[model samples]
Target: MHHSGERGERPAIREKSRGIWRTVTWRELAEEAAALAAAASARGLQRGAHVALLGDNRPRLYAAMCAAQWLGAIVVPLYQDATADEIASSIESAKVTHVFAENQEQVDKLLEILPRCPTVRCIVYDKDRGMRHYKQPELVSYASLLQQGRQLAAEKRDFLQAEAARGTGQDSAFVFFTSGTTGPAKGVVLTHASLIDRARVAAATESLKDTDVAMAYLPPGWIGQNLFSYVQPMVVGYCVCCPESSETMLADMREMGPTYFLATPRVLEALLTQVTMRMEDTGGFNQRLYRAGMAAAHRIDAGKTVSLSDRITAAACSLLIYGPLRDVLGMSNVRVAFTAGDAAAPALVTFFRALGINLKQLYGSTETGFFVAMQRDGQVKPDTVGPVADGVELKFTEQREILVRSPGMFKEYHRDPETTAQARNADGWFHTGDAGYLGDDGHLRIIDRIKYVGALNDGTAHSPKLLENKLKFIPYIKEAVAFGDGRDMVCALIDIDMAAVGRWADKRSISYTGHADLASQDEVYELIAEGIAKVNADLAQEPALAKSQIHRFVILHGELSPDDGVLTRTGKLRRGVIAERYRALVDAMYGGAKEVRIDVEAGHADIKVRDAEIIGHRQIRSAA
Candidate 1:
């Protein structure tokens, strides 16, 4: 395969850092990567050696990844937000002998755990923040390392070429850790061929173009980032832009004007909230105009040809309303956007489509190198995850679990035969653990995880994810977790969108103390009851999940936190863990109790009361 810089002076990466947009051409990237690889080799990093990379979105981090691949060394990326203990565990498990940290804070964490991780020999740090006092003899600055590599390459040019020749399609390119659904993270070994095949398939299926630009804001440690940043770029020759920081993503996005965007449902939800909040701030005249334009856009979104008069109105609105909106959101140039980590609200999908963005859903996992299925342009559907990508064969097991066989599938979980065997059957189909079915139109509709799925005492199957997604579609509800599995009726734990709830409270002059107190207020419950009733009405229209109605619900006193073991680092809920932690609340829901008191483990002892009031409502459908 050709390297990134082989295409002359074309820009390969645009990184905004320290108030400057630094543009690096393919040739420059290739040179820097080569230098870094030589420098690493000089530091005794052999081919097959494991190197841990810890950083946020940065150009040097990307260069280090490419350099590791050039030398046939496996790159193990750790979450930048990881604590010292988590980093140490991953390092020890991967047997990482070398590390590249973005800043001194990470280097300090590595130093703190050095005594336990004997395998780590050398440390190279990028940002020079607060590292002068660090007295480690083995530590070196990234600039110094790159300089050493450049000098070494000048001295032994032929040797560097021979070292670069060591890499091949068969070599293990990356070792991605899973989301750690069970215990600690398990490494999934992916070779160059596996990643490239997946990228090729995704590019062909999506019809990705070389001119397409994708924002690389997701964590590189995740498989999604690797696919979008490393693999897809190699296959489609697209430019990947690194935002200055997480805080400046919206601003950077506006500047980059990316054609292809990928984000989680949480991110999309936040954007929708921002849009709604801004609309609330607008004057009545602007609000009416916005609403009218959106109504027209919705008609266009529904595959209906616009009338000539409506087209003229929409064109005028595009200039007056939508153009500025898209510019402000930095999505004016977006040709295709995707959301996939968790289930997204169909309204959120339709909202973007109504704004003239071709936003769609994708379904995949780390085991498949993040390439499974994508909703093609002009065929986007809100209810389904679209069709399988080219070269991927999907089937349903007897239990209705999705099974996939593709070239992108990982070889095996590192050092764990038992776990690997549990995922893949003897017939070579990888069990996705997801319950889904193929529709009459050949689209795949994922209900929920097979393990999380439960049956009612009356023998009806219940899908909590389906119910939760439906509830989250309500504007006031931020998150909802439905619990029924093995129970007679379904109950829900709801988290309110504070901004939206605050707006409602302000209009009604409902005073509250804080989030916890506001959530427990009787008025808040009434507000949420109305939202829940709307979700129930929507669910009642569906056939399968309609039976599992949300019989009861209570607003959670506080948002779920990682420390509480309720949410993962990526913000995915650990359903079993959350249910176990909130057993008292769940019990109260089914016990027909009006209220329950639970001890919250904050810094000090805090007693909180959670109350649930049932709102009797029946099926009330609204025009779609």
Candidate 2:
């Protein structure tokens, strides 16, 4: 509303539909939000009410959030793809009475869970598809809601304005659910001041302006996405463009050419995998050129330029190769791209910077309102998440767990002050739970979770999560789990990428029935072995991690998924669950057995352990 008063006619939100961009100016956005607020208020919505929004990055969804917040309601954004059971906990915890669902799919999920969540009084749906048959009294279309809102506004214009004005800086704005590796998601509460203050600080630090634009492609449930798309844009008055759907996200990003972009490590790795596969499919000449250009780019990224000829060749390669590659990946116009959520491979980070993209790392979580540390331009390092963010107080615990006290830190863990107390200290420093150190260069370098990372029996440092992340950078490997916490050597359980390895197999005429069949294939194992070899080579270059290189690995029969309880809703591996489920396979990998029993049905595919090829094919006998 503030922006609307200042720049009412400027584009605030843009949504792609039917291959065309549909924009909503600041004035229109404010009007729609106000209307929704008036309508909800007319239906008994009040300040401090909890509102659940289930959808992707839709313009209407953002408007819905604004409307809810305007009435002093705490917005709880659920992952659009979450199942009924997955969201039932959050819905019950927040006592969400009003749900703004994106479409029939989301509405259906809500309907399935409504019996368990009887507090839901209204379900406002945006799309009308497949909704004609529904007879639920709680269901209402968004258009109808707006119509009611318009009527109320005509009679009582000041009502909505007064409601919006009642909101205070300390009022709770959002309740973000963090899906940790092993828990029911925790609802993190953030106040309006905490969220807006950090957004402004980051906006100023980055020199962002109203002219800048960004794509909201990832799941809005993530706090990082909420900050980058919803919170920051409101603070900076920048336009946020949403893609039509997940399938068209890349094409939309390429078309919109968003000035600012944020991607998770998984997203970045997927883009690189696409580039890798495309190059592998091209002619020999193009493939050779890509390799040479990337080699030169790597040299350039490392600041190892030697001669004038090197500079000339690299510049020509950028024009001929990297430039087109950037365009295809929809990052050509991206000014400052960021990667977060999880640790990214150093090589992967360097890969983009080599191509002249200002790719940097961000370190934070849902608890920090998603801004704790960030890499600044020209101060970027592959291994660090730059320095602590501006206006943030940071320190280290005795165990080296990163502790931060930032303006953006969450107010509390909703309804769980005991857990909150365990995380945040009396002095306001929130324990990040991540073990890391601040180097002399003032950059924060993360190793892994304090409890999950330790030393091997030989006293060599072991960080399985870090090792797993690096191995996953290989296009052929989708997920890897490292073991040998107190053992002499590290071993890994692997999950192959169905699309990537399938395409590779098709090109080579390798026969396979399914993911399980592919894993059982000798050739597929060899391919994965080759990928691990490359990871080992890269590890050899890093003195601190070389001793912890993967000694043996077995490709599982299938991918880890949330449905199977092996992965969380946000796709984080449930290590304890996986270890327990595949105890036999783990034993076989360490016992030097040639094979382990497993189940592979049409849907349920468990770990299919085969003899893990040793690093040098020397065959690992049971390590006693």
Candidate 3:
């Protein structure tokens, strides 16, 4: 907020307000945050108390976050899409006594869960269009809260300033929950210094200017959002734009022309699927032109010389197709685009770089403030995460687990010192729990999660995540989970991309009503089999992974979703939970059953049972 004084009259944030774009300057942002801070103070939000922030991305939401920090309170950002029960768990865990709801939707959710959380004392709301009749004593309108703050300011002019001055860099700025693949999520406590330093280094590396624009779409509860939309905006004084809603993200992004962008592998996969589907829907001439342009682009190696003919073709294609394609994807102005949170497909990386997007893979975790290894300019490697980031040190364990130590390393897990001690050794090196190796050029190639890396019964090592990533690159497969740990052969559970595969089916005159019906179709199974076979062919090329080829596979009747507890909020598979939930299916594959009947819990309340045929396509080859 202090940056507002140094950089006056510049737009600090922008978002759609009532169907029109509304911008807030840095000066206005500070004023708004200060008022909110005073109001929160008036509500008995004392120092070190946790303020739960529940809402979609909004200018007022960001202001409240800053306000809470300014008043020396820790901000806890809850996922707006989480179930009421899940939100209650986070609120209870954090012992949050105050909540800042975005609108009536979130307020209703809070009200539903309020009976279970007795500690909550104040409920401050932003949008009150439909909430004029709410008479709960805890309920406070945003305008009224600001009015109270103004009255407090009149009585004590230095109250907010004094609170801000009392804050130290080591104080807990916020606590972000882990994705919780293995178990219940743990809160990772990050301090002001750690987060600020990480953002500073990143901004310096990218040479971000105050004039740069970035989209704020990722869930703010995640460290990535904090770094890109929150910390970097404050550090570099750039404008962070929020979309009206999740559905309008692409449209809003196209209009904003963000200069800096970061998206998870899943998001990139979706965008690629959209692009491919759109191209297939175009006329014959346009489809042929896209294919030709892509072929030309592929010929121009990212870091190598191109022949005169190939160069000319690529330039022509750029002018005719690739350039406009980028504009349509809202990446025409992206100075640096990254895909992280897990390994991105090498194919996706090559595809984007081939189109001149400067797309790179980044490697980090929530505990590291989300900056560890980043691809640098002219050092892009599709198979590696480039090099260790500035101000970070990395080493591998005997078991090949990556260990990181950096100035920006997190302080500890909130209220969980035992787990914190286990995460970091006495030397302050934090175990990343990811198995990887360093290339000759100092780039880091992540294999998979350390615990998930295993060998077959005969001792041929394989990485399930590595294989899964390869399968996901097929575009027909949306999610893949490989199982071979201590087993004789590898098998997989595949989730078809409903949109992409459905389109393929429609083009072939196939009929289907829903995901379940379409996935069960024999033709769809054959298509998935083809994709798995391609992955097997690629696995055969690797000497160490050949024996770990998928010997059997089954297409799931439904997608693995967070609602069913099969996936975490960040889209990570809860492997342990999945294995337990599908124990019967796993046994059938190993028991030599050719088919299995499985029951899938549709959501929190519905169960859907379906029969699936297990197909064994064992192309097990020996080490070359």
Candidate 4:
């Protein structure tokens, strides 16, 4: 609201609607929030009431959240891609009374679960498509909500401001739900002061300017996205652009050319795969040029360049290849590229650095308001997420589990005192559940989830996430599930990135129908086996992890989605569920079978039956 008076015309948020970009000024955003706050007050929403925001990244949703906080209400954003059942648990857990859904699909999910969730009395929808036939009493369009809000604002001129005055710094602002990778999602309650303080720290760390632009495409439910896109932008007075849809993310990123970028390890991997596939498809001079350029860049990155000839080669490569590639990836203007959501593979992070992009890593979680440790510019390390942020202290337990004390720490887990107590102690140290140690350089190096870190049958240490990150860094592989716990040897179920492998196949004129067909091909098996072999070769150097090398593997015939109970809505693997669901394949790999009869339903789509090659010591073929 202060920004509105300071710079009313400044663009606060931008969104692409129906192929055209639209901007909302700071002044307009403040009015919408204030009016919505007034209208929500009329709807019986008060301080401490929980309001739910559901859908993709949109300006209206951001306005609604601000409106919610204007009235001292708590905002809970549910992942747009989450199933109705998954959303129901979140709505029920928060006892959400009012929900602002982005579109009909989100509103429909709310209505479907409304009968069971009696507290949800009002549903405000942003877009009215496919909503004309609905005659639900709880349903109201965003247009209507705004009209009502304007009327209420006119009637009670100081209503919203008065309510805002009652809000305290200690009051809860958001309740971000955990990803539920291992169990049910827990509502992590964070306060206004906490998020605001951390946002400022992050902004100061980056020296963020009002001229800087960021794109918001990730789920609002994820704290990492919320922090970078919503909270930090608000604090730093930067413009956050929301893409039209997930399908248009890359195109939008190219068009907008944001100066700041944040993405998951998965997103980065996919982008790299896309670039690699594109390069491979052109397989002539361009392919040779890219390879030669990358080799020079790698040498430059390792400080192995000693001759003027080497420097000249690298500079030429930068002009011919790296510069154009960065422009194509829409990262040429990116000042600070951040990756979180799972510590990315060191190799993956270094790839962009080699291309002259300042890609860095951040180590934090939902419970920490998303800022604990972040790499500073010019001091980034591929293996470490930099030293702790200002006002944050980090320590490690005897077991190497990381603990943190940050000003941005969560207040508690909403209605889950026991879990909250377990997470934080009397000393105010928050147990991060992540296991890692500090490097001599004073940077934090995270390995994997403390509980998920385990050993093979021979007691050789194995970290599934580390291995999975390494696999995902491979262009052909997408998601991997490593199984070796109490087993004779490590075996993996590989999910081939359809787009990447499909492109490779298409480039070779290899005919295939769908994902299952492509995955079942012997050539695809050879590509995946090649990736695994490279990973094993790397692991062989580390004696402790040598035995943890994957000796056998099988390709998954279908995607592991949330509906299948094998993956959480946020893409975290339910390892137990996956292991049991793919028991036949897992057994076959260990049973010395040459192939596994993969029979898994493709998430309410169809029953897929395919034979997946169990590539082992004898079956593994060298990539041609």
Candidate 5:
């Protein structure tokens, strides 16, 4: 709000609505937030009351967040894609007194869960096209809410300002829900001081400027997006662009030309897959030129050291191919890009860095307000999340579980004192639940979840996440689950990326109906085998991990989904659930069966039967 008075017309948030770009200037944003704060006060929302915001990337959601904070209320961002059951649990747990829904779809979800959350007194909705017929007492149009605020503001001009003045740094800022891969999601409580302090530190570390632009497309519920799109943007006074929809994010990014970019490993993989598929389609002179240029560029190390001849070739390639390719991927103007939340494949990381993009990695969680370790300029390492952030201290347990003591560390788990106590020690160190160690260079290399790190009977260690990331680097592979704990050799169940593989199949003139039919093809099996072989070749370089090579594998009948109880909403595998659900398939691979019949249900009623074809040797030399 202070920045708005000094810089009245600067754009703070931009978004596409009905195919046209619309911007919210800083002054206008402040007015909207203040008005909304007045509305909350009129609706009897008190200090410390939780306000749940559910929506896709939109300006109103961000404004609602600021408005809640202005009234000294804690904001809880719920995933727009969350199921009704998930919504109900979050609302009940947080005891949300107010909600901001973006559209009728979101309002419907709120309606479904309202019976379980009786504390919800006000439900304000934007984009009310289909909501005119609704007769719910608690439902209020977003425009109406603003009007109510206007009336309240007229009655007492300083109402919002007074509320804001009453808030303190120690007050709760927001509540973030963990991905809950192992169990039910936990609400992590963070304070205003922790978030603002860390946001400033991150901005300084990156040398962020008000001129820098960012794209907001990830789930608002995730801490990664919350930090990048919400906290940092506010602290640095940068513009955050919201895409029209999930399907148009890349196009929007390209048009907006964001200077700072952050994507999850899955998003990066998808983008890389698109580039690879496009390159494959280019033929003759262009294809040869691209291949030659990329080969020359690959020779240049990530640090940008290059021979004279290599530099010349690289510059020529950037002009002819690399520059346009980066533009198409929405990374041409990206000054500092990062991939985080999960292990990114080394191949994917190096692929962009080799092309002169400053793609780096960071490691943090909701508990740390999202700033723990970050890669600084000119110190990129694909194998590790770089050095600890300024003002953060990092250590490890005797078992190698990462522990952190930082100013940005969250206060507690909301209403879950027992879990909160378990997350930290008496000395105030927060247990990260991640297995990792500091490298000789001071970079932190994460192996896997502490409890998920396993070993073979012969004592060779295995990190399923590491291996799975390697597999995902292959454009055709989407997700992988490695199993070998206490067993003789590692094995895997793989899900092929249908979009990329489908394009490949079309290029080859192969006729296939759907994912299941295409996956069962022998040719698709060969493609998966090729990916596994590449992973094994990489593993051969490390003696300790060589034994962890996948000796046997099976192609899954379908993609693992959150609704299926196979994957969490954030894409982390529910390994125990997956292993038990597919026990028959797992047994067949270990029992020396060539192929096993499997039954998968599509949605609630459609029964689909397919065969899990095992295709590897026990000795691990070659596929059988």
Candidate 6:
């Protein structure tokens, strides 16, 4: 495609920063990218050199990405929220020769690890926040680099053309690091063809249009963001909007009124919580209306096709109840809203649909270039991941592990042939490591990771993911990990939703110092006990899970965090890690100890309690 400014009249990117929407036209984007490419070449950077782009979402960052592609250079996007050590490790692993820092803080981090990353000869900064004191000879401002590129482009048009000409579909385009749930992050290399093919599939599957407005809120280093923000927009000619900051995402969403939205289940969960919390404070009239509308939603949620009478009632409800509610939540114009990265609660999915949002689930990974399966508009089923995308083949192994073969699959793990061989078989099927079965309708239902699925001593196989998902469906429980493999009974380590629990405590006038005090409080334990009992009652209805019901449980003193390696970036629980870390608590639960003294890591202090209650479920008698 020739570099045409014909699309310049249309907005390509609208970056909302500091409550201001800055629109960049397609022509302006092309010119800026060309200028950056010219400048990089002038800096003596080779065509195939690895360039690291580390920053929050910004127009300049996007420009750099396109520029790198135009020059046949590989762009490595790093998570801006990662710690300095994590950034250093990625920089060293990728052998990045040039670094692009978003602000002074990032520059400082790069400087801290500069001695380790000897390959990084140059650092280009964007925000210039705190670099005034450091007099690094290699440091250069992004603006100055763009100016130099513009100057070079003005003189050497032929050279720039030759550089841009070097780019091809076969060349390596980007490298995204996996979330590293098992070990150190692995670099999944994607060529132009790999990414572009998947983007085309996604565009066709979702029926993406030039008029669609996408909100690019997730970390750009992730494969999901790559598909939504970087690749799909280019393929479908859609406009991608970046919010100002993490805290400003909600406000930016309201202002942009995005037509296309994609977020992890955690984001949706939080939104649902916020909605419920706000509704709890509303008046009787509005609450009654909301209840009636939600009841109507529940009817549709139960797999019942809406009747004409129900549709009319629902339409009336949408106008008076759901429409204003959606507008307030900034989801009024949402044409496609996808929730992935983790499985969401069925009730949560139904809630959105009741409000007229076309929310659906999708399945993919970095190795697959992020497009594997997606639910179509009306064919969505809450219990299963939809069928495989066009041109993709999926099958289940004897072990029930889902395997995939697709055009968008990555070539190999960068510099790790042994690991690559282990992931991809000789027969061309890439082992997904996920345990799932294809339903009668051909939709895939993932239970858990195959590695995590285990059998009890009695030989009953259990899927922890399914049980955990059931537990999380309860509003009070934020996180839960069930452990019972090779044991007689399942037990759980539960993390209560602090906000919800605090509200409950406040209503009862139960005062506590913090999370630790609240968690250990007797009244709080009673509340959580009720929640766990409810979960057990629900689990008892399932044949496979009934035997795996939680026999003993304890509330965690604090929330699990990524910093502590208890939760992955995608918010999936690291069960093994948590099990090891809370060994004392686990022992106490099974060892018949009434109370246990635990050390709080935050304050480096030990907390002692006497005769703490361990909740157990009462077996329900058979109906006569």
Candidate that would win on TM-score: 2
RMSD of each candidate?
2.7, 3.1, 3.4, 3.2, 3.1, 2.7
Better of 3 and 5 by lDDT: 5
Output the better candidate (1/6) by TM-score: 6
Give the C-alpha miss distance for residue 464 in model 1, angstroms: 1.1
Model 2 steric clash pairs: none
Candidate 5 global TM-score: 0.95
Clashing pairs in 3: none
Q: Which is the winner by lDDT between candidate 4 and candidate 6?
A: 4
Greater TM-score among 1 and 5 belongs to 5
What is the C-alpha local distance difference test score of each model?
0.81, 0.85, 0.84, 0.85, 0.85, 0.81
Q: Each candidate's TM vs. the true structure?
A: 0.93, 0.96, 0.94, 0.95, 0.95, 0.94
**Model 6: per-residue lDDT, tens digit, 1-624?**
232444666878899766789998888888888898888878766777889988887889989888877778888999887778888888888899888889988898899899999999889999876777868988999999999998887776787788777778888888888888766789998889989999998788888898899998888788898788878878877888998888888878888999999988878777777777777878587777787777777677556887776666666778887887788778999999998887676777887887888898988888987778888877888887788888889988899999999989998888889999999999879998888888989887887788888988888787777777777766677888888887877777888889988987898899999988888788877776776777777666666667777777778888888778888766777777888899988887777666677765565433222222223334544421
Model 1, C-alpha of 545: deviation from truth (Å): 3.4
Off by over 4 Å in 2: 541-543, 602-624
Instruction: Summarize candidate 3's per-residue lDDT along 1-624 as a digit string, tens digits.
Output: 567888879999999765689999999898888888887887888889999988888888899899899989998998877888888988888889889989999898899999999889999999998998999998999889987877776565588778888999999999898888767898998999999989998889889999999998887777887788889898999999998887778778889999999998988878888877777788686777777767666656555566787777677767777787788888889988888887888888877876778788888998997889999988887889989889999998899999999988888988889999999989999998899999999999998888888888999986888888888887888998889999998888888899899889989999998988888788887787777777777777667777777777777778889888998887889999989887776777777776666655554312222222323234433322
Count of residue pairs whose backbone atoms collide, per candidate: 1, 0, 0, 0, 0, 0
Name the regions of candidate 3 deviating beyond 4 angstroms.
283-301, 600-624
lDDT of 4 by residue, 281-382 (tens): 778877877777777777676556456766776688688778888888878889988998877888898888878888989989889878888898867778
Candidate 1's TM-score: 0.93
Q: Model 5, range 1-624, lDDT digits (tens) per residue? A: 876986669999999987899999999999888888888788888899999999987999999999999988999999898988898999999999999999999999889888888999889999989998999999999999988887777765677668878989999999998889777899999999999999999899999998999999998989888888888978888899999998887788889999999988888888888888888888877777777777677666554566787778778878877888888887889999998878787778888876668899988888987889998887887888899999999888899999999999899999989988999878889998899999999998888998889888999887788888888888898888888888887888888899988888998999998988888888888888887887887676566677777777887767888878787777778888999998887888787777776665653212122233223344345532
TM-score, structure 6 vs. true: 0.94
Ranking by TM-score: 2, 5, 4, 6, 3, 1
Model 4 pairs whose backbones collide: none
Error of 1 at 440 (Å): 2.1
